[model samples]
Target: MKLAWLRSLESAHQDCVWACTWVPATDRSGGLLLTGSLDETVKLWNPEDLSVVRTNTGHCLGVVSVAAHPSGRIAASASMDSFIRVFDVESNNTIATLEAPPSEVWQMQFDPRGTTLAVAGGSSASVKLWDTAEWKLVSTLSIPRPEGAKPSDKGSSKKFVLSVAWSPSGRQLACGSMDGSISVFDVQRAKFLHHLEGHTMPVRSLAYSPLDPRVLVSGSDDECIHMYDAEGKTLFSSMSGHSSWVLSVDVSPDGAAIASGSSDRTVRLWDPKMRAAVQTMTNHTDQVWGVKFEAVGGGARGSLLASVSDDKSISLYNYS
Candidate 1:
């Protein structure tokens, strides 16, 4: 299998595009592409022609993450300023604005059921979950501090969270931190389960396999991609090829393959069964920041992959 380049938008964003997601097709509209950039704007695009449908401007700092509700009627975007704006997709009207003081926001995701939002709480050393109905701070799944640490180290910087992922069942949440620790939490009980460890540097991105909730994939600044059995708390395999930090990673819709983008300026496709990188695409000039698989209603769109980078562009590919 290979990634066939379909098209690319040069300067899709005025500055670095940090995050991207597909707003699933609802009765009112088809699947649309949502992207957040260092330009401080969130832009929605048509999948057919790559034309801008809307440009949302409110974030004062670079938007760090964007997540769409499963129903596609609502979406949320978070910026470096620790604010999350939950808005209506078609009307562009604000549903709610959420912020946890002193806790910087990084990656965010709506639960598969769309009833809760899980946010990576940087510096706060926790995963913040907000309920959708009332948009209230429902739970804080804080990462446990290291053993033997001093009492003075409360809110320790070593565990600052940078990425999070909800299992397909929505019963569990995993968060990656600055200290290369990934914490697993039981969502139902709001309990900390365990940590999966290996990478020595920060882990910046994570995803759970759609086919198996226990299978998790992560990319780290240590230049490695790891597959883990999250429930068993074990690392299955580690693939290394990128010469720099592996910035982003995602499992394909079928859960048979993994795709990753890295600071090494390349996008790679890896086969979990082979435990090796099968293909690499040199499509960006600078560091690649985000890589995502379009998970719209199965047959409406082909297997598609989107990658954003420090090069200020977006590239779409056919994952066949």
Candidate 2:
């Protein structure tokens, strides 16, 4: 696997860009890029030329996560203040503003079928699933505190969830926490399945292989990327290379490689089979917060990867 630098947008936002995702192709336009930043805004970009399409404003605090609906008609952005705003992709109109009182929101994603939205409930120690059609809270998958742990203990406090993901089949949901534990859940039964443990620091990001429902990859503040069997509850491998924390990670569309962004200010592409980084790109001078691969393929762009950094820039890459 190789990554060729396509283009870089300097000062893409006034502040750090923390989250990014791809809006799939629609009848009106091809696939476009969506990004959220510390400047309290979400921006849309044209992938072909790496040009700005539009800027969305009104978020109070730094936007922590952004997720696009599968149909490319709607998108959601969540900020540190715990508000989730869902808007129309084309008209940029407000569709819904969602919030769960006392439960801060972090990374969020729409299910594959776009029926439910899964959000990481930061202090609530749970994953909140909201129904899209009605925009109402459907259920909460709470992560039980460990045995012999008190409700006011540090162990419960460290369960601050930071990221969340869904399997390819949409039957399983996995969430990563500040305590370095990953909890997998059965979506159908709304039951907490088990926990996958290895890292001792915060797990900032997670992504499941598009081709395999059982395979899961995570990036942590421990400066390592771990591969896990979601069903078997085994950490099969851990790869480390970055000098600092691994902030973000994504699997390639074909499931051949993994791309990671680190606080050390570098983007590394790893060959999962070889269990090593094949290439490293060090163009950003500040911590890289997000790395994302386009979900679908076709149109003018084939396979694309995008990265955002605290240096206030956005970089696009060609992955093959």
Among the numbered candidates, top lDDT falls to 2
Where does the lowest 10-residue lDDT sum fall in candidate 1?
295-304
State residue 164's C-alpha deviation in candidate 1, in Å.
0.3
Tens digits of lDDT, candidate 2, 28-110? 98889999999999999998787888899968888989999999999999998679999999988999999765448889999
Kindly give the stretch of ten consecutive residues in candidate 2 with the minimal lDDT sum.
294-303
Candidate 2 whole-model C-alpha lDDT, 0 to 1: 0.92
Give lDDT tens digits, candidate 1, residues 160-270: 899999999999999999988899999999999988988889999999999999999999999999999999999989999999999999999988999999999999999
Off by over 4 Å in 2: 146-155, 296-302
Residue 206 of model 1 has an lDDT of: 97
Clash tally for model 2: 0
